[model samples]
Target: MTLFIGFLIGCAFGAILFLGGATSYRRILGTLLLKDLWIIKLMATAIGVGTIGIYALDFVGLANLSVKPVYIGGVALGGLIFGIGWAVSGYCPGTCVVGSAEGKTDAMATLAGGLVGALLFALAIPLLSGALIEPLSFGAVTMPDLLGISGIWLALPFGAALLMVAFVILRERAS
Candidate 1:
């Protein structure tokens, strides 16, 4: 019953992802080209809100930071590489899966490439541990932590940033 429930949840999540255009190659490509940053902005803002909410919950003793130390260098390098590869390939993991379901040959290639890449990364963990690692911000360490200000104080700047991004998107859309 537990396994069946998990399967159903995963199926539901996949359905939502597909319906949300979360797997749309064109939308992903638009982000890279800067032709349409709406999807990118939406994702960024949503993630920001999620991060703040999670931290707030953790502070209230309702949640925990359940992640380990992050490697900053690896993250930066990975993001750079991933962005380039994603732009060139025209599909990401989720999109690739959805496209594969729709019988796309290129999406199949993307999925195969992702599998092989993951396998290679797993095999290279030992070599990468020392060579590519760097100190990363972990825990609920946010601007408030570093600046010694209450989180509520930092919300203003965050709101300003979001507003600026929204303005940029609006201008882009208008022109």
Candidate 2:
């Protein structure tokens, strides 16, 4: 049942990506080149809504929130790799999935490469965890904990900030 629910959600999200032109390599490149702002707006909107919705669920006692330990080195390295992939391929993981669904050969290749990378990472974890993950661990810091405030307090300001940023980006693009 859980897998079914996840599958349905994934399908819906993929459909949304396809319908939004997010699956297009050209659109992704345009976003990177700042010639198009749709993808940025879409991502910003998703982040904003997800932030608010997650917090709202928690506030209403409908969700249990958990924060993973923050490994600074791991995050930095992973982000660098991810940035490289996005810049080179113009397809982030979600977009890659959407493109693959649409039968794009390049996206299929990207997805295969991602799967191989994930497999290699998993295989290397035991060997790399000590040097790459644990030493820089900044244990489970949540915004509420860092700010010394309630989750709602932090979430409202953060969500608002994201929305404001998204609006500014769209407004600038419009001009």
Candidate 3:
């Protein structure tokens, strides 16, 4: 049942990505160039919805909160690599999957590269953990905890902010 539910969710997400034009390399390029705001809007909406849904689930005791250690150096390095990949290949990881499904060779390359990178990271983590992962670790902290606010309180405001961003992007796109 859990597997079936996950499969259904994955299908729905892929359908949304395809229908939203996130799978199109041209559309992704347009987003990178700031010529299109559709992807940004879509992502913002997803984040907003996800934030609210997650917090609601947690509030209702349907979900357990597990926070990962914040490794700022790792995030910065990952973001740099991600930005370069997105700019050069015009496919972020999720879009790469959708693009690959649609027979795009570049997407296939991007997916292959990503898998390779993941494998390499997995292989290297233990070797590099002391220098890379532990240096700047803030252990299991969340924004609400840091700010001394309730999770739900933080989530509502964060969701609202994301919704606002989405609204602005869509409004500008419409105009």
Q: Positional deviation of 108 in candidate 2, in angstroms?
A: 0.6
Computed on alpha carbons, the lDDT of every model, listed in order, comes to 0.68, 0.84, 0.86
Put down candidate 3 lDDT per residue, 1-175, tens digits, no spaces: 8799878988888889999999876677687778888888888888898899889889889888888888887888889999998888888898899889989899999999999999998999898788777998888888889898769888898988999989974767821
- Runs off by more than 4 Å, candidate 2: 167-175
Error at 103, model 2, angstroms: 0.2
RMSD of each: 4.6, 1.8, 1.7
For candidate 3, give the lDDT.
Answer: 0.86
Residue 53 error, candidate 2, Å: 0.5
Residue-wise C-alpha lDDT for candidate 2, range 1-175, written one tens digit per residue: 8699879978987887888789886787788788988878777777787889889989899878888999998899899999988877778999999898889998988899999999999999899899988899989998789888779877777888888878875867821
Q: Which clashing pairs does model 3 show?
A: none
Q: In model 1, which runs have C-alpha deviations exceeding 4 angstroms? A: 1-17, 70-72, 98-103, 134-144, 148-175
Q: Candidate 2, after superposition: displacement of residue 122 in Å?
A: 0.6
Indicate whether candidate 1 or candidate 2 has the larger lDDT.
Answer: 2
Q: TM-score of model 3 relative to the true fold?
A: 0.91
